[model samples]
Target: MHPENGLPENSPTTRVFVALAPPDPAKDELARALGPAYAAYPRMRWNRIEDWHLTLAFLGEQPVAAVDLLRAPLAELAASRAPLSFALTGGGHFDERVLWSGIEGDLEALQLLAEEVRALVREAGIAFPERRLRPHLTLARTRRDDPASVVEVAASLSGFAGTAWRAARLHLVASNFGRGPGPIRYRDVASWAFRDPAAGGHSR
Candidate 1:
């Protein structure tokens, strides 16, 4: 059994999630909109641009061996799905603790994709909580004492809208957070491109 959660302790484990990330240009557009927030809420914990992603399935703390079981199935799923078109638009907050940017366009397709992803994880024998899909990219978090900061910042982003972009890849990522005192870091364990027939069955 694992020392932390007692699932299985044969090998080390990492917290994992499957997600779709906005392209660099799209992320840059959102970053520009956040400039004022950055200055006003300097104490808030802002997520790095590179770490911003729309999580499809959160498979928290899985043994490395269990995580490896997901690779092939996820790749095949990605190969069958078409790219999704979406844009960053507006913003919101969750209980004034978290700040997030909302997503717009092709929402039906996005929901379908998320459902399929969660199904795939289940088929791989990975157990995770099932939560309703709320399409948003987490931007930052405010301290418990500074509740108003997120509310104000979210209001500032009310009218912000970014250019639409194709989400072409599905990323299986791992984060190192609780294991150490250093800043949390996210890295891809594997990624698969959406199959585009016009692009010769490859991602552009």
Candidate 2:
């Protein structure tokens, strides 16, 4: 089915995911930490700072109609949850192919949130493979010919620790990766701010 405007089955589908993005100041701090790696490993495919996010659930490709069904339920979920506090710390590589920054602080809360998001998608009848949650922010990727670069860069970021920030919103994002030429681009399809119970479920 078409995933764009939910016109019909002939319309294009979008790759979607649920996530939390760091604020500009938090992202800037991480950018500053990566300055040296950016210069040293110019060949690495670095993700754009604006695209940096901590994924809560990857919904894969879904029809626009199906994705639309998630909005109301997700909004209700967000309204029941409070903001989470977290910080970006250290770095790691996945099989020396993808470089990522680790997450710290309030991990238990983060896991619970991820679980709830996945449950909501499933309850909506969306079928996606279940995978364990490993919280990390993808930073860059290394080419097959130069596998060592990611390892070196990851080591350089061992002591890097970003400032704490409250994750206030849950975002439904659409990506066009591997669907066309040029770099992958991401845009928000929907978002909801966390509601504070003490404040009468009002989003701050």
Candidate 3:
């Protein structure tokens, strides 16, 4: 199934991703850090703090039955790696429509995670999207006419450095796209803990 957001019935319905979520304290810190920038671009759709996550892989719509099959590998992966710490820095837009914050620090770890997730998807026989890994946390969406504001907003956010937080859990979020003005509601369908580092690829 595809992710819950904007999917048709009878088709894969879940839009899935392997992600790193900030702890509560980090979320609070990010909200506090971004409050002013949020006001500067009043028209942009700023994502809610609770929905902030660093996505490692985006598994577009898939059949529901595959969720369990997908989870098994991710759980094993999580159990091996230690929680990663990363910092947010700068902002940019994708075709003037999507606004996102650049990620830094521990980037090697993030890259490794992406590679591991890609391998797992292949082993599961999932049709993986052909795209390079460009790590960034999407923060807002900009309207056409108001795109100029995002450019300035990105520059203003150039120095934002939120506190590093644990990446202890990987959430399988279900998104409801195209029907809400607020942040997409995400729920954990399954989770796996970090296994001992000595377990080869599974280790932190």
RMSD for each model, in Å, please?
Answer: 4.7, 3.2, 4.0
Which window of 10 residues has the lowest lDDT sum in candidate 2? 1-10
lDDT value, residue 28 of candidate 3: 78
Please provide, for model 3 over 117-170, each residue's C-alpha lDDT reduced to its tens digit, 9 standing for 90 to 100. Answer: 888988898885757789888888777788787777777777778776557776
Query: Model 3 has how many clashing residue pairs?
Result: 25
The reply for model 2, stretches above 4 Å from the true place, is 1-10, 197-204
Candidate 1 structure quality by residue, lDDT tens digits, 1-204: 344432334558878889999999999999999998898789998989999999898888887888878889999989988889999999999999999999998899888888989998999888988888899999988888999999999999999999999998999888875766544677788889989867565432
Candidate 2 C-alpha lDDT tens digits along 110-162 = 89999999999999999876778899999988888999999999999999999
Q: How big is the positional error of residue 35 in model 2, measured in Å on the Cα after superposition?
A: 0.5
For candidate 2, the per-residue lDDT at 106 reads 79
Provide the lDDT at 152 for model 3.
75
What lDDT score is found at residue 31 in candidate 1? 99
Please give the distance, in angstroms, between residue 195's alpha carbon in candidate 3 and its true position after superposition.
3.5
RMSD of 2: 3.2
